[model samples]
Target: MALFVGLTGGIASGKSTVARLLSARNIPVIDTDLISRELVEPGQPCLNELCQHFGPEILNEDGHLNRKTLREKIFTDSSARAVLETILHPQIRRIAKERAEQSATQAPYVLVVVPLLADPKVQPHYQWLDYVVGVRATPAIQKARLLERPGIDPPLADQMISAQSSDRERDAIVNEWIVNTGDLTTLARQVDQCHHKLLMLTAERTSSE
Candidate 1:
């Protein structure tokens, strides 16, 4: 079997940057965030279920997901958030697994980017991962990065950061850490190290088998 590695981090923690770096090195990466978005496209079963539960207001006039409206609803209501997760998380995991398996045909191992992998509720579902790497930045840095995004005010940015797993929590589960506290060059160097480590692990697994 091909080794499956998980890449995860909190909001604004540079997970995308790491994934991009890995892709640049010719690594095969299956990103759950992208899968989740695809799963909710117009006429998809996930979107249909979401409309049933959250109402049609969650969709824009063009039939795409009105993310802002859904975000406001979920952030204010825990039960609503739970419902959304219930409808989407399993589908995301299923598609991610499928893509990873397909990618494994061409790569020694597959990298799966799961933004919420450290959450207690989400962690159990990913036990099959052979390894997990976490990208981390200080809370202050996370807040600053979040606030820079369009439509992200101070209060919403803070709320989003607080809702994710803490650095300590992530550290407890991740096998490796990539600290993203500096410029692109610094982040790129760390990603290069991580890529080399993953290649070593993949070779070891292949030889053992």
Candidate 2:
């Protein structure tokens, strides 16, 4: 199987930036965030299951997942939030893990960017990863950057943060930690370092599959 590297971080912690840099270097990345979105696409099984559990209110009139409405509804209800995660995360993991395994036979490594890898509840499902990448950003930096995200409300952003694992908790599972304590250029430099490390690790994996 491919060397499956789990790249994760807290909200606004530069996980996406890390994923982008890895992609730029021709490293294939299987991001759960993207898979979650795709799984809920109009005709997908995930969308059908979510509709049955959350009702059509979670969808826009166009039948797409109305992320805003769902965000508010679940974010305000702790149990509902967990229930949603229970439903969506399973499908997201299934697809990402499958693709990652497929990639291993063709390449040195596969990057699985799961934003919730640091969360205690989610980490258990990812122990098979060859490495775990922890990303960090100060609360101020996170809050400031989050304010500018498309369609994000400050309160909702806060809710999202509340749902994530703490930085202390994040540090526990990390084999490699990417720090995002500065500008984009600095962030890119750090990511490049991590990318090099990943490349070395990938090269070390035998191609015997």
Query: Best candidate per TM-score, number?
Result: 1
Task: Please give the lDDT score at residue 128 for candidate 2.
Answer: 79
* Collision count of model 2: 1
Per-residue CA lDDT of model 1 for 1-209, tens digit only, reads 56799999989999999999998888899999999899999999999999999999999999999998898888777899899999999999888888888898887778999999988899999898999999999999999998888888888888788877888988888999999999999999998988888888888888888
Quote each prediction's TM-score: 0.96, 0.92
* Model 1: colliding residue pairs: none
lDDT of 2 by residue, 81-119 (tens): 888888888777788888998777765678899887877
Give candidate 2 misplaced runs (Cα > 4 Å). Answer: 205-209
Error of 2 at 128 (Å): 1.4
RMSD of candidate 2 to the truth, in angstroms, is 2.0
- Candidate 1, TM-score vs. the true structure? 0.96
Local accuracy by lDDT, each model: 0.90, 0.83
Worst 10 residues of 2 by lDDT: 200-209
Q: What stretches of model 1 exceed 4 Å from their correct place? A: none
Candidate 2 local Cα displacement, residue 13, angstroms: 1.3
